[model samples]
Target: MKAPALEQRKLLDLQAADNRIAQLQHTLRTLPQEVRLAELQRDSVAARQEFGGVNGELEDARAEIARVEADIDTVAAREKRDRERLQASSSSKDIQGLEHELASLKVRRSNLEDIELAVMERVEEIEQRLAAITARRDDIATEERLLAAQRDEQRDRVAAQLEVAKSERSAIAGGIGAELLALYERQRERYGVGAALLQGGVSLGTNVALTESDLAQIRAAAPDEVVLDPDGACILVRTEESGL
Candidate 1:
């Protein structure tokens, strides 16, 4: 393909813009906030699960305490009724029996109260744990929000730069002939670079110097000639440094 020397240089500008856009995309995908956000999400799930289990245990403890207190109240009432009947009775047997029954009830009430106390302590511990888990989850949520906002801001900046780069690429492409532009695009897809500077008798794309015959051939060609690498990897755009 034949492209004027100036038009060939435009390929470099287009390639630079393409490279910047690629970098921007890569930056968006691999932002540090993205990794941290993923970790926080996993932690948030685990924290919620722990909070749920602790909350269930706390409820059970409270229910058990209530049941124990009710039993204590019922036992106290029974003891009071038995004492009243014993005071009204004239028989010694009835009085002794009431005394023994009252002692047993006292023991049972003491055991139940002990259990209630234990359950109350357990409830307190569970509440503390729940609170701690809730706080941690909230902290994670806050950090996630902040980081997400920052990530979005960074992405917006990069997006703006990409739009400008795309505009520049479009303008540069418009200046080149259609056939040359098509070929450049194809070669760029294949080799990452569509054209290279011919400098110091070398194709910069391959970093290999041209032989005496090749140099003579390129020198004999027109100023607007498009030279291909010996390996045909890319087009060579001649410059003053071509050492012709």
Candidate 2:
């Protein structure tokens, strides 16, 4: 494939733009906030789960406290009735039985009260824990929002840069012949670099010296003539650096 020497050099511009676009895309993908955002997201999920568990425990503790208090109330009511009966009855046997039942009810009430106290304490502990966890989770949530915004901002900047690169590449590529441009694209796809300067008797693409026969061929070519590398690897764009 042949293109005017001056037109062929435009491939370098296209290559540079492509490289810049690739770098910008990489920047978008690996933004510092992206890593931190991921960690924050994970922490948010775990915090929610922890909060849910603690909330459930708190509810259960409250229910237990309520149930125990009700039991205590029932026992107290029974004891009150037994005490009244003891005051009104005259038979020794009846009074004795009522007194015994009142004593038993009193013990039962005391036990229920103790259980209620314990449940109430558990509820308090759970409430405190829930509060702490909630605050931490909220902090993490706030951080996540800020980081996400920063990440999006960085992405937008990189995206804009990429668009500019694309525009520049398109304009530069438009100046070259379609057939020549197609050849460069094909070589770029195959070897990652389509064209390079043949400077100081070396192929800049591979930083390797050109063979003697290749140098002879390039020297023999006319100005504005495009030449292929001896290895057929890339288009060699010659300039003052060609050492011809």
- Predicted model with the maximum lDDT: 2
lDDT of 2: 0.86
How many residue pairs clash in each candidate at the backbone level? 0, 0
- Alpha-carbon TM-score of each model against the true structure: 0.89, 0.91
Residue-level lDDT tens digits of model 1 in 17-72: 77777787788778778989899999999998998998899888889988999999
Q: Judge candidate 1 against the unseen true structure and give its global Cα lDDT, from 0 to 1.
A: 0.85
Best by TM-score: 2
Local distance difference test, each candidate: 0.85, 0.86
User: Which residue window of length 10 is worst by lDDT in model 2?
Assistant: 223-232
Pairs that clash in candidate 1: none
Regions more than 4 Å wrong, model 2: 229-231
Write model 2 residue lDDT over 1-244, tens digit each, in one string.
Answer: 5678779888778778777878888897789997888888899999999999999999999988888988888888888888888899999999989988888888888888888888888999999999999999999999998988888888888899889888988999899999888888888888877888888999987889988888998899886677777777777888888888
Can you tell me which runs of candidate 1 are displaced by over 4 Å?
A: 201-217
